[model samples]
Target: MPGTRTNPLRRLLVGRVQGVLNNRASGETPVVRSAHALYPPDSVIWRVHGDVTTMMIGGVTALLLQMLHPAALAGVWDHSTFRSDMLGRLRRTARFIAVTTYGERAAAEAAIEKVRSVHLGVNGVLPDGTPYAASDPKLLAWVHVCEVIGFLDAWIRYGERGMSLADQDTYVAQAGLVATALGCDPVPQTRAEAEALVAAFRPALTANARTREVARMVLTQPAPSLGFAPVQRMLMHAAVDLMPPWAKDLHGLHPSAIEVPVVRAGTMAIAQSLQWAFAGRATPRD
Candidate 1:
């Protein structure tokens, strides 16, 4: 009540109601409901939904800026930190996917090594282990290319922000080379071909239930407990806050809405499960 004197009762009431409405809207709205239907009701759904929503809102904001103040937006895009953060996030996510999906630790290590072997290869380091050699520029290029492919997949499949026809082609070209370098074939040209490729890889994944379980666990974890969540949140907030005021007004996405602590918790649990499946004891803390 003391603080309420300055805040004003009317404004407080309105803010509280808006918060409730937003929460309900996020959960039960058509888009979110459709997302839940598309993804089995699981932690993966929550994580993906949150990510796509954030990206969509962010993309819209960027598009608005491009329309209203193209020069300003271009400047922001050209900022070194923006590129560094994006590359770092992609590299980290790619390593996680590679390690979990392949279930071949040595191959993952080798792939990272190959990326580092190239010139101008920054942001190609493994998340869990120290690099065996100095980062190679070529290796960094390969990693970034692979990440572009992954990002495109997420964008297309999940409706993430900022994906254009041009971006898709760029991803395809980069991914093709990266795949070839890794002795993996390029992604199929068509969606059908992609499906076939996925099916072909399905057996390997299924054969090792442990890997699938680990991936599932990671997918379900909440953000706060994840090693990367804090950093990710900070970046997300900064990106959102940097958008023009009108863009923020249009989207009405408060930064707090994107916060997901559960993701980290789920990842930790899954990591522990992976250890057990691999004949190792769960960590004492787990």
Candidate 2:
């Protein structure tokens, strides 16, 4: 049943989501769905990336964590288009992840190479006059580790509470395939390693006006339209709720105890809806 053809509801939901990833008109192909992908379909990376709802929450948490580093913040403050078209920037990011995670291996490699080429032009001096480059392997590792922990934690919390430690490490290592291709040095191949790496970078992290402004825009950017406002708000809350306590402290986000359960339940509702919409469509082994 899991590999059966999609129904109308499935198509409808997917169409809306794909609309953001590709500028192609609805019903036009947005991303490739090769039976031959970068990873075998059974891989943990596929399961985590396939789930739309949790990935949205995880992505926000990753961005929030990433902005804490002044070097990371400097790159965004200098090069990002978030100030004018936040949604477009987010969609492009999502597209990159989707393409790398699910598209054919050649397509995935092309996407990674495109990013590498772009990084070539991204070097600049920070406010403190320290030179920074997106191509720096250490900086690439920071970005990769943040994303690995973010997606893994979000999947465990919202998608599979009973996921095993072995699987968690597997997820980290599986994601490292892409990281290595992108030239991220010291990519963590296990959850424990990922945790340790984040701690190692913590001393270098800080928050100032630039950090707050980026966080505010990331958290409060308007929905694609009014119809999506409530969904966006819940995702923002769930992301904050799932974010590590230390990160929340850095971002000055303190969710009340009363809001925690409410956010969890609402997010679960969204996750379930997504699960249903994707039912019988594809398998991890597809």
Candidate 3:
């Protein structure tokens, strides 16, 4: 049974559809090409970029909705002074991302450790089967830097109007750290190296089997109620409206725009597939 605290509509709004859509294209592309022609290097990079973009967009959209409707966030945004609290949270998140130096082994290790502690399973498996130990500050720093890049991309694509110049600089710095951790020059310097770095690290950046399992469980399990039924309904309505026409048709319902749903779904599927690969897994569960 659905948990009494869970909002069915909200669950549907932020459902597996998002993950499936984000990772679909790239996951399928190789198969499609294997049956026909060799997948071009350019195509692979494009697929990764596309998936990354989709993730940022989805995160941004969810963040915005949460901000607009505190109750929908399931206690993440339920304080009496939610807006101020949220601002503090965003600032801290940004600062965390802004501090890392690129290509620093210490930084990367530090970042990775921090991420492991959260155990969101986004990184898949650690180098060893053991839970990530935060002993190395460098790994933690690098991971934090990469996350900042992800968040920055999301901000530019979806929250550009609200971002400041400081945010852009911070993102650039984080990107530099990502480049450094991957053993590339501070910048890719050339398209080939850029492609190579991306190819090499793509597997490490996404959700792994363990992480996906965690996400799936979190999504499927019901959360406690916070008395925001109307707000939750509104978010659902907005998410549905944001879906593409193809999705609308698939779900047998019309939404605000058909294009967003279609693009978003396709993008998400690819992203999730990449995540699985990074985690060193064969494929994600349907």
Provide the lDDT at 195 for model 3: 38
- Lowest-sum lDDT 10-residue window in model 1: 277-286
Q: Write the per-residue lDDT of candidate 1 for residues 1-286, one digit (tens) a residue.
A: 2343244543443333223223342242212122212222332322322332233223322323222222222222333243334333333433333332222435444554554353223332222343322233323222333233334444443343455655455444433543444443344443344444434432322112332332223223234334445434443443344343444453343445334344333333433332233221111100
Q: Pick the candidate with the highest lDDT.
A: 2
Q: Write the per-residue lDDT of candidate 3 for residues 167-254, one digit (tens) a residue.
A: 4554454355444543333343333333344344433443234333322332222212334233323333434344334333433435
- What's model 2's overall lDDT? 0.83
TM-score for all models, in order of appearance: 0.28, 0.92, 0.30
* Alpha-carbon deviation at 1 in model 3, angstroms: 46
What's the best-to-worst order under TM-score? 2, 3, 1
Better of 1 and 2 by lDDT: 2
lDDT of 1: 0.34
Among all candidates shown, the one with the greatest TM-score: 2
Pairs of residues at least 3 apart in sequence or in different chains that clash in candidate 2:
41-284
Model 2, 1-286: lDDT tens digits are: 5332457766665555544445554332466467778888788888888877788899998999999988888887888888998887777788788888888889889999999998878889997789999999999999999999888888888899999999999999999998999999999999999999999999998888879889999999977756567878998999989888888998899999999999999999988876777665442112
